[model samples]
Target chain A: MENRTAREYYENYLKTTHRLGRILTASVLILLLAAPYVIGIYLKAMPNIPAVLKAFLGVGIVYLVSGIVEYLIYVPMLGAGGSYLAFITGNLINMKIPCAINARDIVGVKSGTPENEIIATLSIATSSLVTIIVLALGVLLMIPLQPVLQSPALQPAFENVVPALFGAMACKYYRADRKAALIVLTVMTLLFVFVPSLIGSTSMMVIPSGALAIGLSYLSFRKKQKTSEGGNEA
Target chain B: MELLAELNSPVMYLICGGIILFVSVICIVFAVRAYRAGRQLGIDESKMKRVITASTTFAVLPSIGILLGVIALSGSLGTPWPWLRLSVIGALHYETQVAEAASEAAGIGGLSIANMTPEAFATIAFLMSLCIMWGMVLVIFNGEAYSRRLVSPSHPEKGGKKKKSGMSGFGDTAMTAMFIGLVSAYIASYIGTIVSGNGMFSFQGSWLPLAVAVTSAAAMGVFIYIKNRTGADWVDSFSVAGSMLTAMAAAIFFGRLIG
Candidate 1:
């Protein structure tokens, strides 16, 4: 995508991707709602409307603010078709986003290119397919595999899997701009330590941490530029 | 058939299986499109193939976790809805919490198949789906604008190329920051409990999660070494998964030994 000509090629294809992405996303929602509808139809039971509202309000309200924030934070990083796929497939922060970043790193493409767009989409789509296949197999094999999946020997690992994952991952990007990564990491860590309850609200915290990282990285960028300019002058 | 006994019944499998199949079809369709786009954009053919392999490998471990989520919820909600939910963006963290909240609101005694009347179960499903759509709706309507604005400052013009920024590009920096922020939040949560003396592992002196993290990071170092020394292209594919699996194993051993 960095090749200027490649971007022009994107212009040729963007329309179809965008239209399909939108329609697919809309259909996913309808199909998702259809789950409950079908269940209700089969059982001859419609949901209690007031109860639905109450539960929705109770569950949905807290998530509403965070959901919007997640959308804003993730969409740009992922790009057009990738966002649609990742959002519909879910597991953005935990799985899809990291998978995308890793794929880009391995393939040596940076963001903001048509190539990057393609890479992100490809990796996420790969991830989604793998997830579905693996899960479906697990569901079918549930009785036989339950012991392995839930083995006490592996329970501890599953419990702390998130931390293990990010520990391996967070080092890659932050190392590029150590100062920024450190600053954001320290601030966020301390904030969470003192306010432990904030752990549940990850979506909201992304904004402030992202703001600080960008702000600090800008300073480092300026210094690096100044040195380069000085070398040129010399 | 009594609804309770049918919680894990064939009908439920058909419904859930249909959703998974649909998601898979969409995923493959887009994957092909992305491949074509990659070729047009001049990405190396081999590199694109490697990306698919790497992503699939990386996805393996997490998919196991997600499967566990479906299994966990199936005991109560039956396999279908949980399968449908987890298959499509319904995370364990969110699915369990929201489902429980809705079940409680519907006055189910607990999150149990026995306690779930069809009506209560319907409410849970509807409310859960209804709530989760906030991000989806935004993506459909305004995703392009939001994403465009994120990178627009660098572009400045519709047809122009990006200016080389002296600083870290906003795209990379913003993403890095968010990642650091998110992981920090997770780590901090564990530490917070420890500092407050509320952490279960602390009394036992294991620092279970931290140990797991360090072990995983170390395992990643090993993976990195394997990648570098062997020049195994596949090593990069397994780095994250290997790190996670090894750490998990270490967590169990360390937890039991010390605690």
Candidate 2:
């Protein structure tokens, strides 16, 4: 009876999250377009439809695929409320994802639990708010901070932010399953070495690498199970 | 450049500022809801506070990186638009690429402010706003269903008893694998530059990124060691943020040494 009550609460919470998520997302979408439309109208310089379409065709088609792929790949990890806020606020790969993952790990919450969902949402929300505050500060201080921010001496640090971030993250996560990590890392390294252009497609590559790791882990699990069974028989 | 001046005008700032304010309010609302739900779920208050503090710390450096993106784009796209783009749904690289493509397609010749007109700005804005909006749309319509499907498989609520499928930890393993795949690909590409003598960065063939990554990984190792030894919970909270800043600082030293 307690389990049933818990299940009902979880279901109701998800239902409320979805309802709120859809409404807020739809509202934000309108506001996003409204920014450009209001500007165009205010300036009395509306966009030419043909030119907009042409420009969109040049890049939009590719990003359309990317948008869909990113949604599918990231949503599972991000959970419900987290996904809604994250998609709206953006910067998933660099900021939101890492923040959510770190919070979940720190609190020792398993993915797919109510605890995990709440943690992910809290972390993502906090990250988003921080980003907004930072960006606002940047805009206010752009003049004073321009030289420091745009200095040649600082370019390397900014350029290498991804490596620095992921390096630390990888260290933490790889310890969980060293064997799978080794196999995936080696295979990915070899693949990149051969087809260097694939460097640009790291997001898409996660699919195959994840599948390979899962397969290897499953095999290891089976092997251990069989070993225990054989020892019992002996 | 008349339009460029107007683009950065007070009205533009107001619009961008308003949008950011709206987004911020939503963030606060969600955060509040999540915190209440967490308390209901019996999460320790201190743990949730730690999550908030750690997330705030982890966010600072990356947010600065994004600020730099705004600064970069502002040279061509004006301050307000780039600020809005970076603060909201757009990334640095994507925003740059799309703005360039839209400007060129609009016959503005590129992302040069000299040739930017209202019409061209409008074109850029439309393309930038339209193309990236699909992700939000997908999340709106499909996010709940997708999340339900993802969690139901492993959820204890779905099955009253835990199943011993020998696949107990696969979700975490998969997440870790994806991250490893991402980092390895990045590290390998940097190494590949050394092998092929061609890379995307100006300092091609230099071991800059790989060296930076190694230094960062070492820093992380040190943080983890310290956390284990001292039993300082704050070390755990600051590990990633501290490692990233240390590695970024070391990047300057490495850049000078290697380049």
Candidate 3:
């Protein structure tokens, strides 16, 4: 009975979330396109369409693929509502993903559960709101804050945010499964060391490294199952 | 400079600000709905509050990092556009790259505010806005279906019992592995810099990222230890933020020392 209630609640939640998400995201897309259009009309400065397309073709093609890849890779982890919010807000790797992960861990919610989805959505929405506020504040204070924010002394901090963040966040997960973590880390490190040019392709690299880790983990799970079964037989 | 100033005009701010305002409203609605759903799900109000607090805290430094992106791009793209872009559906790196490309294509000679024209500005804005939007578009279409697959049962048998999906069993591990993969790649890239002497920071400053990472990791370890030992709930909320700050401070310290 409790299961039925929970399932019904989740189904309704997804229904509402998807409906809202579609409308909101579609509206956002229209607004985004409208920005350039409105600007072009106001200034009577329409861009050369061919040139824009040509240039976009060069870079947009790459980002288009990356965007699709990121969507597929991230949507599962982010869940339904969180994906809508996070994808729209951007900064997934450096901010929203970590925020959601941390929230889930702190609240002790398992992934793929309705509770986890709610927690992820709440956390991502809060993060997005905070980000918008911060960006607004920074814009308002860009003059006064410029020197400190752009200072060479403080530059390293911003530059290393990825390492700083993932190091700490990854350590928790690494601790959860040390063997898989160590093996994957070693393999990725070697790959990067050998083909340093591949550094720029880290997003794509998530595929191989993830597969390797998952493969190792599955093997471990099977081995553990076998061992337990043997002990049961004994 | 005049063209650049024109690009930063009040109309531009209004357009950008309006979009940002809309996005914020969406965020609020979603957050409220999610919160209510949590209540329906029997989640403790205290826990939901903690999630909000933690997410807000965790967001500060990174959002500031994004602010730095805006500031960097403001010199070229003007304050309003960068502000709007970074505030919604724009990443720091991608915005910079696409804006540069668009600017070059517009004959602005690659992201220079000096020779900017309205046409070039429009081009940059269009390309930057349009290029990275696939994620959102795809999500609009497929997000619900994909999410359902993740949590729903896969196979139904003759007895009317549904078999558990592979995603439910392996989702957590896959997510963890993806994170591990991401971190390893980043850490490895930094390590590569140290070894190859050919990457972004150069050999001299190459050690900085790795050192900062270790410091952050150690700070995280301390936070976890404190949380475990003292049963302090706030420690969990603050661990990532605290560790990031510590690591950033270490970066400055080590940066100066190495120099």
lDDT on C-alpha atoms for all candidate structures:
0.78, 0.82, 0.84
Fnat for every candidate: 0.67, 0.67, 0.72
Candidate 2 CAPRI level = medium
Per-residue alpha-carbon lDDT of candidate 3 for residues B118-224, written as tens digits (9 for 90 to 100): 88888888888789899999999888777776653321221113434223355677677777766776777667667654754345427888898889999999999
Q: Which stretches in model 1 have alpha-carbon errors above 4 Å?
A: A1-6, A202-204, A226-234, B150-168, B197-206, B226-233
Per-residue CA lDDT of model 1 for A1-234, tens digit only, reads 564665566766666777888898999988888888898888788877798788777768878887888887777778787999998999887799899988988887767666678889999999999989888898889889999978877777777767778778865555667776776777876776666566566556666776677677667667777898899999
Best by DockQ: 3
For TM-score, the strongest prediction is 3
* Highest-scoring model, lDDT: 3
Model 2 steric clash pairs: none
User: Model 1 misses residue A49 by how many Å?
Assistant: 2.4
Residues B1-259, model 1: lDDT tens digits: 2665576778878887887788889999999998988787677899999999889888998888888888889888887778889889677779888888888888995688777898888888888888888888999998766655544332345523445454335566556666766666555555655554343333422267767777877888888888889898778877888888888778889768864
Residue range with the least summed lDDT across 10 consecutive positions in model 3 chain A: A1-10
| Residue pairs whose backbone atoms clash in candidate 3 | none
Return the number of clashes found in candidate 1: 3
Q: Return whichever of 1 and 2 wins on DockQ.
A: 2
Among all windows of 10 consecutive residues in model 1 chain B, the one with the lowest summed lDDT is B197-206
- Candidate 2 deviant stretches above 4 angstroms: A1-6, A221-234, B152-168, B197-204
